[model samples]
Target: MTTGDRCEMPPIPLRSTPIKGFILDITGVLYNSMEGTDGIPIQGSAHAVNRLYSESRVRFLSNESTGTVGHVVGKLGRLGYTGIREEDVITPAPTAAEYCKRNGLRPHLLVHPGIRSVFDGLSQEDPNCVLIGDAEHAFTFKAINTAFRHLMKMKDPLLLSLGCGKFYQRTDGPCIDVGAFAEALKYSSGCRHVVIGKPRGDYFQTALDSMGLAKDEVVMIGDDIVSDVGGAMAFGMRAIQVRTGKWRSEWESHEIKPTLIADDLLSAVKACID
Candidate 1:
C-alpha cells in the first residue's frame, strides 16, 4: 500500500528533528499479536515502513519472544512489509544466545516454543544461566518455581531477560509479557537480571550499532511510553509515540516527552520525512 492510498487522519504537527535512522517496535507499532501474519496491519504501517526503508536505514526492533529472527522477517513479508531481512530485525533471543556463548554459560531457556530455535546449540543440561522470554504456554507456576530452584543452586548464575515489557496488545486485549515473570524470578532468587530488550541500554545500543549512526541521529517510534519512548529518549535517541495498541491517555503526564505524537506509524514517518 502506498501513502496516497491511505485514509486520511488528522495532521500531526511536524518536528524539525533530523533523523538518519529509525528503530521501530514491531508488535504494537507495525503489527499486533492478534492474527500473526494473517493479522490486520496497522493502517499505513506498511507504507510508512517501506518509505522509511527507501529513505534511510530502518531496523525492526521488537521485544516479542514468539518467533526467531527468520520467522519475524518472514512474517513481516507476509504482512506486506518489504525489503526487510534477518539483519534488519533485532530481538532478544539472538542477543541472549550470543551473550551466553561469549561467557560460556549454559542457558536454561524459558521462552516460547516457537522461538527456542534461536538457542538451538546452547546448553540446557544443568544450566548455569537462566534466560527468560515470553514463554506463553510454558509460564506456569511450576515452570517459574523450577527456574527459581535452578537459580538458587547455581553459583552467581546469570539471569537474562529478553524483554521487561509489562504487557503486549492482542486482538482480545492486553496480554501479560515475560517481564512480570522475569521479575518474579528475580525477586525470589535475588539475582539482578540483565535485561537485553527495550527500556535497557543494551537493547538500544544493539540497534544503534547496527545502523552505525549516532544516537542523536536516530528516532524510535513505538506505542509504549515507558519502554519505547522513555527508553529511547534515555538512550539519547529522539522518540515518536503513536496512539495505537497499548497507548494510554495517562502517558502524557509522564516526564519523558516524545519528539512528536502521531495518530499512527504513517504520521510518525511523515513527521520524519516531510
Candidate 2:
C-alpha cells in the first residue's frame, strides 16, 4: 500500500527550539470545526496540552477575534483542556486593546460584536485609527465604508489589522478572514496598517513577554504554515508545523520551512519536552 514514489516522511522529528514557553494556535491545532460551534477536539491535543503544562509555560495564542478570551477558555475546558487560565489565552481583540492603551490611539472599532467588550475602556470619542478584526457579517459595505471614511479623516490614517490571514475554514466552507478586510481598507484609505495577530512579530513578542520568556527560549506550534510556522520563525523562534489543521503536503517545500514538522500537537509537544 505504500507508495514508492514518495522519498520518505517520518512520523515526527525532534525540533531544536529550546522549550520554556509554548505558543499554540487554537482553531485547527487544538480543535477542528467539524462538529459545529463547539469544535471537536483533535485527538491527543488535550494530552499534548497536559504535557505542555508540565514542561513549559504554555500560551494559547490565536488570531481568533470572534469571541472573548473567557469564551476560549470555557471551550478548552469543555474539550478537556484543564488548568488553562484566562490570561493564558491571548487573542487579537484584547491585544489590540492593549496596543491602543500603550500607543494612546483611539480606534474606530471594526471587530466582532461578541468581543467588543475588550475595547470597552478604550477611548472611542475621537477614533484616530481603524482597528479591524474578523467582524464576520459586520464587514458590510456600510460598515467598511464608514471605517474607510474614518481612516480618511484621520491625520495619521493608521489601520491596525487583527491578523493577515486570508481565510478560515468554517463548517460550511472557507470564509474571508480579517486580512482581506484589512487589505481592502488599506487599498481605499492607503493607510499605514499594522497587523496585530499571528505572523506579526509584535504579536508573538507580546505572547513571549506574557510568559516571561525570550524568543530563543520559546517554540510556536500550530497547523498553519504561514501564521504559526512562518511567523514564529521570522520572529527568531523555533516553530513546529503540525500535520493536523491547515497543513498541506505541497507546502513542505515552502520558502519558509519550519524548524521541524510534527504529526500533531502531541508530537510537537513531545519534541519540545523530550
Candidate 3:
C-alpha cells in the first residue's frame, strides 16, 4: 500500500480456509473519531464486514474507551455495518478486570470516571489497577504527580493502558495521542504496563475464544500496521493492512510491516479471505 489517496479497488481475497470470524480495529479501520476527512466509506469496509457476518460468525473488536458499547453500536449502524452484537466486542479494560480477578489481583485505578464504564465489574473494595483513559481536557501536573506518587508505592500492581493513540495523522503531521502520557508514566515509574489495546495479544485471544474459532480460522483486518497487523501476527493469525489510517508509507518506513497491504478495507478483506 502506497501513501496518498489512490484509485478505488475491488474486494480482496477471503482466506482459503473457512473464516470462523474476524477481529477488527475500530479507530482507523472502521471510523475516524474526528470528522471531515474526504472520508471514502473506508472502501469496502461496510460491505465486507456485512458480507462476513452473513457468511459466517464475525466479531468487531476494538480498543475504544471514550464510548460505551451502545455508543459504538450506534456509530457502526450509522456507518452501515449492522452485523455486530454488543457482547461480540472485546476490549482490554474489561478483559483486564477479568484477567485480574482470575489471577487474584485487584488493582487501584487512577483513571477518570467516564472511562471506568468500559470495565463492567469493578467495585470499590477490590484492589485497583491504575486505569487511564482519554479525556478532552489537559491533565494538571499536580494530578500527574499524584499518580506518580501512587505508582511509586504500589508493588507488582498492573499498569493498564487504555488504547489511546500514540500519534494521530493530521493535516499538518502526526500529533501525540493522550496515551503518550501513560507511556511516559510507565517509563518514569519503571513499572511494566500492559497495553491492552492494539498490538496486544490479549484482545486477539479473547476474540478468538469468544468466537470458538482456532487461530488459523481467523484473519485480522485493520488499517494500522502496529495495532492491526502486528497484533494479529503475534497471535499467529493472518493480517492485512490498509493504506488508510496511521500507516503512512514514508513516516513509518521500517518500524512496522503488514503481512499484506491493501489499498482499502475492501481489498484488505479480499486478501484476508484468499
Count of clashing pairs, candidate 2 = 0
- Ordering by lDDT: 2, 1, 3
lDDT of 1 by residue, 1-274 (tens): 2244543332222344467989999887887668433455788998898898888889988887888888888888888886788898998888888988898889888889988888988888889989999998789888888889889998885688887889888888888888899889888888868887898877898998999987878889999888898888777777889998888777755556677788999999887888
How far residue 237's Cα lies from its native spot in candidate 2, in Å, is 0.6
Instruction: Residues 225-247, candidate 3: write the lDDT tens digits.
Output: 66677778777787777777666
Pairs in clash, predicted candidate 2: none
Off by over 4 Å in 3: 1-18, 35-41, 104-106, 119-121, 124-128, 136-138, 169-175
Clashes of each: 0, 0, 17
For candidate 3, the TM-score is 0.80
Ranking by TM-score: 1, 2, 3
In terms of TM-score, the best-performing candidate is 1
What lDDT score goes with residue 165 in model 2?
89
**Which candidate number would show the highest lDDT if scored against the true structure?**
2
Error of 3 at 133 (Å): 2.7
Error of 2 at 165 (Å): 1.1
Better of 1 and 3 by TM-score: 1
Stretches of model 1 off by over 4 angstroms after superposition: 1-17, 35-37
